[model samples]
Target: MKLIKKNTERGEEKKKRPKKLKRIKNANPSVVLDRHGNIIRRVDGTEHGDEKRGGQFLAALFEKLIPPGTKAGNKKQKTEMRKKPKRKAESEYNEAVPYDFPGDIIRSIKNTAGDFAGIIGGKSPSAGKAGEEKRGGIRDAAPIRKLSAIRRKFMSLSKAMRRIVIALSALFVALVSVCALNIWASGFRETWKAREASDAEKAALESILDEAFADERSEKLRPLPYRTTPAKLDVRAGAAVLVDTANGCVLYEKNADRLIPPASLTKLFVMYIVFKEVEAGKITMDDIVPLPELSWAVNLPRDASLMHLGQGQTVTLRELMAGLAVASGNDAARAVAYYISGTQEDFVARMNAECRALGLKKTYFVEPSGYDENNITTARELAEFARIYVTHFPQSIEEFHSLKSLDYPLQKNLPSWQKNYGDTLAIHHSNTNPLLGKLDGVDGLKTGFIYESGYNLALTASRNGQRFLSITLQGQGKGTKQGNEGRIHDGTELMEWAFSTFADYEPGKDTSLVFPVPSLASKGNDGKFVNLVPAWKNKITVPHLFGSTAKDSADAVKVVVDVPPYLYGGVKLGAQYGSVKYKLGEITLETVPLVADRSLESAGIAGRFFGTLAKGSLEKNR
Candidate 1:
């Protein structure tokens, strides 16, 4: 019975094996069978008989040759291959795999493997229908074969060479990323800075407007002073203006609004700021100010006017002012600016602020020293500035500006050798202004010169108890010989003409009529008018230099009175009720405040009721 069972089992096993072989043959028709009727396998574990398997093996070889992500394969299969579990002890596992094949043997194995795959994958179309129907042919296999060759050659390189290639590739990628990031970051930074600057400017403008109009009230517009037909003065200045310091009246102007380079005359504003600081007690004349590094670096050049300040030297604010006003020392100016604001740039900002406050429309300062030609202003605006300066800080002119010469540095702080070798090193400097002692009552204010501005002067003088301020900008000629003389001559001529032509006239002694408004609620004088009197006995100057008589002066003067259209009761005595402007032709020579001569009680309740009724009736009738 056991023998019969064994024979049956062997028969069943033999039948099952033949069925499996039949299925394999059906699937790969190109599979070759040996003489023993068994399948043959290559060294790479692929059936030598099946062309499709050979093609798949060739694709696997080529996968190693191509750059990453360039392989042709099913995405799912590739991803699964990448995610294959890593060995727990990878180092030990690699060490256990003895890959000690000789270079030539290894190369031979790779070549055979590639050739086998290529022959099956790259079959000619006429050779077999099955190969022709396959997706890849010799066209595809050709590139793969080449890639394999290249990969083999790369693997044969020295270890150091492979490492160098990998490092260079990484460096290239890093550089690209950094450059892209830098470009984006730089653009963003610039845009942000511009936005911030615009916002700052907008805020500054708003603040300035708020401060300027804080105290303003809505009122009826006053008529602008009419321009009078006046005698034109012969003047040689490129631009000239003359103003009465008492009332801020423009007596004469020629090309007064023309823009011109201010040159060192810009120091006038610097000194003005200095005086303001003194008044505010931020600094004092007796305080010691250190000579800053920037002052030495910028003003030590021979071309720049300087006070010959030495490195690390300390100076009094008073001495610096003397250098600035009398010697026109640019170094002294810079030092003072730095001492006050910690930087010349901040001082320049303060200057522009003052300009805005003073309503100077056409003035700008680029530097405190005015060494740069970019500093600019109009004659009319500068004359106005001088008026303010003299009115507020008259002592500045008296103490610092009238001097003919000043000894700068007080004592030579430089070594004897440097002092002697330096070219035209001046411990003493003569004032650039030529009219210091030449013209009567010509006290101050500033003089400026450069090739661009030629020569300029801000002059103030008092004659017959009336102070006049004048500005002469851009005088003609070249060098000290012609240019200096031309400016001085022009300024002298303007001052002489101004004082000779105009004489101050008091209206009290003149035949001018003072208009009186009728009192609305006065008890004794019910309909009587009260005579208006000047708040102060102020005088207006009239031009008499043209051989004009007193009658002509009287005829030239026209009065414009500004009185409220309606006066309510409860007006107090000496209260300003209106203003009377005295004009010579159309130009206003002076405006005097008109005051009440007597008080008027509020029309008692009944009086106010009747007054309102009368006003309503008058309007109804009109």
Candidate 2:
């Protein structure tokens, strides 16, 4: 009997057939699991094993689907099957057992029946071994035959999976390429926008100024370039500046911020402060300024701008300011200081306070005049301060700049010898602003120079209804041998260049694309359909001066729409439909959505009735 059982088991195992792959009629069979035990991705035949994040996802998914405690059982079964040669051929296991055996019963049976015949014989109490083997063979053939009948099913599914995989790969590559291109475009756009200048504007101005300068030079006009002779300055020891007022920008500079001596330029702030006081009613033109005797001895050589104040001289506050702004007057600065604060020291403290308020980032003053080296500032800071001063006190400053000279009345209380000094003498004063009485658009400003402060100008001008402020400093060159002519020429060249080669461009509507909506409405509650328009126009100014900060060319561009809440459906016009804020160097420009902001009218009377009926039917079914 034992020999008979052994033969039966061998025969049953040998007669087993291959398993049929499960499939739908006319559909493809599922793929075998990949190396990760994950079913191959149906979209693409490219196995999940080849993808970046697929392995971990597959592992997690397998962990969830497999039965609990089945891991060890499956591993043991696989190991035994590999060792047993016949196990590899035992694929015909298609029929499911009708009854579920108890766990304990199944375990005992599995342990006792080590081979195929043992299990079959247990199921049949008296069946012969030959019969058992024959029965097993017939049953095994059923699955193999079913698989053959459905071959067409799996073929179609596999082809579709291959196409899906290829398409997905192409799409991924294209998306990556677009992202890279956008990044490159952003950086290039910034680089192009930084140095945008208007060459055309400069050319037009140059055509005019070059003729003026050439005509003056041909005549060898004294002080035409506003200098006695060619001179170079050692800016390392001190500094100065010259400015063009037309472009509202800088012209020339050299260590202008380096601390040295602030000559009469310190009085520029004093003038600004006094004017502010006058505007605020703290003082007036008629207010008396008590002259101080010591002010005359503050700076040696007496070259400083002054009205030669004597003690007890009662000078009007307005006259004192005129002397300071026009003549760089030290004595006038002192008189104003004394009249306002009763002491020069207190007045200097106020000067320091005003500097901070004006956004003069690099200025500090120790005295009212440029005599003290301790009082100093950068040309840029001075220019900014001057611009602020001009903007605030346009009338007074303009009058001050307009002066060619001034006269002082003899002090009625002065001694006989001093009486001759105070007279309405012909004071021939030249305009100090480099561009003053020079450039057509140029107007009155100030000029400064000291052994320690070099030549400086805080200039401003207007052209085509736009104003500009520029400053030049420390152009005295390496030695006193250098000339202001070169500095003046440099300032002119800079100003002329600024007005050319740049233009403001408004974003045209053609680049805009709109999404169409079947339903649209009008704000008047009249029109049935309305198209959306852009809310704001986008503008960009191109070709600017080197080192100039980027500015938005668009004066007022934004979004216009037909609907109140533009996005009514799940679909959007495009990825860039909402708003795009682009950066060109330091400038930020924005574009808004072009969407149809309209809706279908509350259905006409008949349409509303039909909708109501439809709603009723749905309600009744529910």
Candidate 3:
């Protein structure tokens, strides 16, 4: 409580108390100790311990890296490290990291950092006015940022060529693939060009035969009237051909390509067109005739054959067809033409169109009536037409061409004005076909003879199911009787020869003869096999006797089925898979294409790719 003279009493106690230590200004924050634990740098009133130095890694590294020997005997270096630094160098070196390390690393790459970015440009912060020391440490005049020699060398080679190498490799692969595809395409192009050339050649050959056109001053196609030929029978006709209807095989041919005037045989094609129209529902045999003045027998030449048609006659198309077929009447032909197409010119145009459509190159018709010689055809071409005619209308033989005779102008054929004049008006015409009753199984076709063209006949006869079409043209003689006898004799010989030589056979039709093709069958077919059949009827006409009198059995013929070993998926329906060959000893008689029975889809990308590998392995194993 009594506080009198406090300052005087404190002064008296201070004289007896101990003295306190004082902290110095701008002194070292740490003490540098040598290995013996002796302090090199001391600071007043501070206790230094190893604990604080434990966290200062740089200071410890510097102490180990900087030995006493690198410090020169120069008094200036000693003074610079100990004294307080004024610029950035002093604060940077305050840590244990050496400031000269950058210069030591970059000295081999660059001698100096002259005019560097605001620092280390040929001078140091701690250097004296004389010059900077060039020792291999951070003291050299270097830029603020420096890199070693290895790092600078790496920067110069920065552009990598890896992407370029990869691109070139890809281009090389594509070029190789394109070259392979081009080679394959070239082969296909060559094959296509070859086919085109073959077709062009065939068309050219046909043009030569078609040169004997109507109304032209050309010579008749005459190749030896009596040729010692393959049929072993001398034919008196200029051109003749015997073709088996079963398989279209030519049994005998002699100048069959020669063109000649068809004469009355042109009616055969006229009847063919009429039959086609009937089949197409365009006309019927019961159609009434159009009795124009051009159709009356009065307008026709007196020598022209007729059914004695008069004006105001009530003839039907059926009667006209019979008259044209059996009587070979020119009047009936014009009348029938007018009945169907309004004009003979239009009907002739239709005939020509049908001829071209049927691929008969040498057969040309200027008029439907066979009384004119301008109607021309070749034996081979007529035979081809006869084949199609029979194939389309086999019944035409019984209905029209095979009739023995046609009697017309009866009560039914006469008009109402002449109904009571039946017997006086009636006319009888016998069949003009010379082979009708003379030859057995000779139903009909037609016979033609004109002054300019000799006798011509398109004859067909079927003894068994096998049939042969015989075309005999230009049977030359002095008169119509001689010409008629020649053609009839030639036709009868050819028909008999063909029937006895070749037999019609349909191969691979028997269910027991089904051919198994290994294809996509394993993948989709339940039976694990695809059944391949002939693409066509596969009917072959071959020698059943070969000069023998007896007919042979089917077992005597040899059938060879040729097919691929295996088939993969993606096969199309009706695609040709192989072939079936009909053989006789060493000779191959006929070959028919065997086609795939069904279509199959692709399995997948992976399945296709691996399937190819498996196929290769299969071949190798086989």
lDDT of 3 at 340: 77
Itemize residue pairs with steric clashes in candidate 1: 226-586, 227-586, 228-585, 228-586, 228-587
Model 2 lDDT tens row, 5-94: 235655653333555433212112333455544455543354545634455755454455443467697667545644545532212321
Pick by TM-score: which candidate is best? 3
Give residue 267's lDDT in candidate 2 (0 to 100).
71
Model 3: per-residue Cα lDDT at residue 5: 37
Where in model 3 is the C-alpha error above 4 Å?
1-229, 509-518, 521-529, 544-547, 553-555, 605-622
> Model 3, range 127-160, lDDT digits (tens) per residue?
2345655443234433423444334433322245
Q: Model 1, stretches more than 4 Å misplaced?
A: 1-232, 297-299, 412-426, 506-539, 545-601, 605-622
Candidates by TM-score, descending order: 3, 1, 2
